[model samples]
Target: MNNIDGLDSWDGDRDQSVVLSEELRSRLAPPLKIGNFSVHSRVLQAPLSGVTDLVFRRLVRRYAPDSMTYTEMVQASGVHHARSLKKIMDVDPAERPVSIQLFDCRPDFLAEAAEMAVAQEADTIDINMGCPVNKITKNGGGSSLLRDPETAEAIVKTVVDAVHVPVTVKTRIGWDENEITILDFAQRMQDAGAAMITIHARTRSQGYKGAAQWEWIRKVKQQLTIPVIANGDITSIASAVACLEATEADGVMCSRATLGNPFLVGEIDYFLKTGKLKPKPTIAERLICAKEHLQSLYDYKGKRGIYQARKHMTWYAKGFPGSSELRGKLCRVDSVEEGHALIDSALASLA
Candidate 1:
């Protein structure tokens, strides 16, 4: 396969050492069964708040058509009080196998919000028990649930009863280094009727730093009868392979690594299925995607989308010659036209 400019093939010594053994291929070949729902791909696109919006998910879906995608985590209380679907909960009908993620400490509000999500055609309801943001935790939500497993269990049981679709959870290992409570937490979730549990492998104190503790995932996988997805630090096909082999978990979820790189889930999924790496997108192709993303965001959300597109544009402007200067300009773009012009100029330079 052709390699992109400034991009290396997966034939490097490190990647070469990490092969997809026949055992792994056979193990992952079957559809991932979650409750009564079945997902054909072992790879999943994670629910990133403010990042996995409908526009971004559309791009990811274009590549990983069989993989499951998630909506940005919606505040259950916000939806319950407003009695209206939040734009963040929006899922295109065509994006099958997509889950609507909800966060809050109140089981009643979450159950009410889940019914609304099902009305919008959600394939599953995901509880956000693992978010580390203080804003979420301070209000008796997110990772704070780790400290309150009783409430977490109650939330899961209530939502499962309220929704026809399966109820799942995404969470970190524990409150901090001293409290690695995922072993007990994962089992409790299963008993409470969670169809699946995604473990982020980091404590709440670690935030996004430090290496993910995959060993904990192995321990959880051993105990839980439900499918366990390993979620921290899975950035590439190599890391995905290593994590799967080490944890022997059911699947992998792509997180921060997919920022500007929507092709990641598809790349990893292709490798797992075919044992071959798909060619990386060239800098020119990446810039073109950035332009499309900028325009689409503008078309969808207007002025506010332009502001949001700034971070996304900068994310795509990397690794090529003059990329530092290009990122500087892309991050300050005031309009879609300006952003398109900047990417066009960068593409011309690469040519």
Candidate 2:
């Protein structure tokens, strides 16, 4: 029980896999200190464009309290030019140790935006260089920065100098196979004063396809002295273990995997700390969580939050049979009452 420090309130039957080997326990339990903030858990929430809002982050936090979460990647230009983009900075003051990840090629805008993120009480300012979307890459941001390391370093340097909080970079292996630049790009960012780095382990051309080349992350980690977090293809306990063993990264960052199963980040964190695997939740629990997730979004975004909750519901609806049907019904429910009805029907059927 002393090993599992924070589960006194957990009602579910505890899994005994909590004892970690001294080697892995030592390796896995490394805390990341980025500038002024120290992350108690190394499992980080990657900045998904539309997915990692304040509500979604809270859901993940319930399970993984110390796991650091990120905001949806904001556009530096948008933050400077549009109040709409600035809205992304709005987060609960309790969501400390959260990073506001931003993207843009403009050094000046990045500096100003980093300052704004500091105002929002962000734990750190992260520059996103791994996004492969054409919109981000075409404008000289995201993985496109991989193709131009000089600009990437300048962006990091400007932001680091502008804010008291640590500056971090999340990036891919390279622009593509032909332009794999992670090793060099990571070095430049660190030299420019980045406190730590996260590598998603795929090239720009790979997009979200194929296995994340975690080997590239190993290469980057070998070259960097600061803490390096390994990402990509880390959806389950097995993959998380494999990636860490392969790359020797300081910690593992979870991205798309936390979609519906917010408990997964916590599950993995628990496994790392105690070396135990918890059983996956039952359908009843899943539906209850889905309803809670929806209500939280509605509380945060009102009616418009329904649209956002739809995707999260769909993700949670997976791993069991007939999930597609549940997803279909969820998509049509526009109001909280309607949404609760849909969950009720789904839970009944599952039961």
Candidate 3:
């Protein structure tokens, strides 16, 4: 298989060994057996809409080949009735050991989507019960499931029976502070046969605000028989370590943090396994990745590729000088050449 810039191969960079030796106080990792799949890596890539596309996943897979990655959440109702959704569910062969996440509250529709995911060669099917968007909630999907555990569990039971693959769930603590029902709700899901659970430690009302409630993750882990994956508010190596240390979750999944930094998933997974920080990618490395991402978007979407790449380029440009202005310019780019020139100029300024 041709590697994208040798993504699957890494010899570790300078100080890699030294850093590994420094973080020897190993955290207890929960070993989860979901159906016939076993993941040795603790950090999973939480499915983010529009962000966890095939190209973005390829970037992340390069650094953390074995770490579990997720596609952007697929709408089951849409997938059941539309060909466009099926195209979105497509996974590259290089992204083996990956899970396809789906949303919607209808058990029957979700079941059909699950079967489709199986046909597409997914190792697992993930149900999304944590999205807070008004549209999704209004449709009785996403975080709205928190308001109706009965329906959520039914979706799981139906989907589990429909597919031979393991079915998992990604959800929040509750719909809002007043509706905290995670402990009981999670138990119901477990009873209904969800193989694994990923809990983003905040209520839907919080909407990615406040500190992630690591304590809630600890509570779920203590209450559930399956592996409990912790997510939310983790963006850096230190935060990743802290999330694991505080929650005692079986694994950590980086959502927004993995946005521009594809190397994060593998870097953290490697640190957990070998206790080391791989060498940081330099400015040149970032520029190369940005260009490759631009080209891939072009390949994936044709003339509209520039529009799709704008957000990705903006995400990659974070933590650099003139980033915000560059993002504005990138968002307005209508051609691939212009996007490339903007990124090249940004990289040159950094040098």
Most TM-score-accurate candidate: 1
Find the candidate with the highest lDDT and give its number: 1
- Tell how far residue 297 is off in model 1, in angstroms: 0.5
User: What's the residue-level lDDT of 55 in candidate 2?
Assistant: 84
- Across 142-168, the per-residue lDDT of candidate 2 in tens digits comes to 888988888988898888889999999
TM-score rank, highest first? 1, 2, 3
Question: Candidate 3 versus the native: TM-score?
Answer: 0.90
* Prediction 2 global C-alpha lDDT: 0.81
Candidate 3: pairs in clash: 20-275, 64-266
CA RMSD of all predictions = 3.7, 5.8, 5.7
lDDT of each: 0.89, 0.81, 0.80
Clashes of each: 1, 3, 2
Flag regions of model 2 displaced more than 4 Å. 1-20, 83-85
Better of 1 and 3 by TM-score: 1
Q: For candidate 1, lDDT tens digit of each residue in 1-351?
A: 111111222222354456899999999999999999999999999998778899999999999999999999999999988989899988889988899999999999999999999999999999999988899999999999999999999999999999899999999999898999999999999999999999999999988878899999999999999999999878778899999999999999988778888888998898899998777877787788899999989999999999988888787887778888988898899998899898988888888
Give the lDDT of residue 238 in candidate 1.
Answer: 88
Count backbone clashes in candidate 1.
Answer: 1
Give the 10-residue window scoring lowest on summed lDDT in candidate 2: 1-10
RMSD of 2: 5.8
